[model samples]
Target: MYRTPALLAPLALALAASAFAAGEHDHAHEHQPLHGGVVVEVKDVDYELVARPAAVQLHLRDHGKPADVSQASARLTLLTGTDKQEAVLRPAGGKLEAAGSFRLAPGTKAVVVVTRPGKPAATARFTLK
Candidate 1:
């Protein structure tokens, strides 16, 4: 009857809206860590941050391929409770690394900013668990 169509119209519209929103999201991007680090995606690139008590390492991948970071540098800001610390990471081997004693623990948050000449900086936030 006419009432049946009217009642299904709202459901159809809701389903269509959800499908549209999902199609626009990048959930298909691979989020698995390549170096046992927390991975975050920014601007179609994936950044992995590995935190340890003795050193920190960052890895970058674009479209599932290793990104060239030879001319890149990174700064990291780590926040844990009321204590905060910072470190500068430079290109080492093929990744950016900083060597120092760090105060890392569960629930810590880290913000990383990577900069390269003639390119905009890429930033990502990670929470350790």
Candidate 2:
């Protein structure tokens, strides 16, 4: 039986649109910082960095829920103009914490390298304005 193009066009379009939406939904998520930090997503995981004047915090989440980072460690390197600083982050409670005064200023940049058990290392970059 022959079908009219007008009848088939919408059906085909709907199928295509739905497939695209489903694929996108499964691959990426909207990023919102839960801890007043800059949020970055890497392979469906979210990393939030809250760089304070005297402390540094790194929060992790997967799919909007707090991620288990008990076995994870991160190294944060801060860059502000010609001055540079680095800190080792140990898992403290839900976030990785480090104690020290970071000379954070406007236009500062941070590069974090996170290592989790049995997973490849992930790196995220953030900038403070």
Candidate 3:
């Protein structure tokens, strides 16, 4: 009986070491983002709102775990040349997309604000080039 405990101690230590090594291996291939917390992907479909040729299409994707977006709200501000327009986004096709009246061009700067239910609001800035 005493020998069994002695054997178990070594086994536990070996298992722990293996787990640590595996974690280190995973870290090598992991790509860490600049900021922490969940990430939302925003894609402008047909809009450039900056360069002045294509219409803007904003695609907001939840890169984190799936959560309810019923209460979520989003606002996008697009700066195109000398004009600026604000778009209020609504949830559509599991993403929030807002269409602007004017065609936004590439290399334009945009501000997006997303508010999820029961979570603090998040804001992101992107340049569509």
RMSD (Å) per prediction: 3.0, 4.9, 11.3
Report how far residue 50 has shifted in candidate 2, in Å. Answer: 0.1
Off by over 4 Å in 1: 1-29
lDDT of 3 by residue, 1-129 (tens): 358888899999999999888855322222222222223243211111222332333333334333355667677787878888887766655546555465456656677777777767767776755
Best by TM-score: 1
User: What TM-scores do the predictions have?
Assistant: 0.84, 0.78, 0.51
Relative to the true structure, candidate 1 reaches a TM of: 0.84
Candidate lDDT scores, in order, read 0.91, 0.90, 0.54
Name the lDDT of candidate 1: 0.91
Instruction: Tell how far residue 82 is off in model 1, in angstroms.
Output: 0.6
Task: Determine the backbone clash count of candidate 1.
Answer: 0
Estimate the overall C-alpha local distance difference test score of candidate 3. Answer: 0.54
Error of 3 at 77 (Å): 0.3
The deviation in Å at residue 58 for candidate 1 is 0.3
Of 1 and 2, which scores higher on lDDT? 1
Query: How far does residue 12 in candidate 1 sit from its true spot (Å)?
Result: 5.3
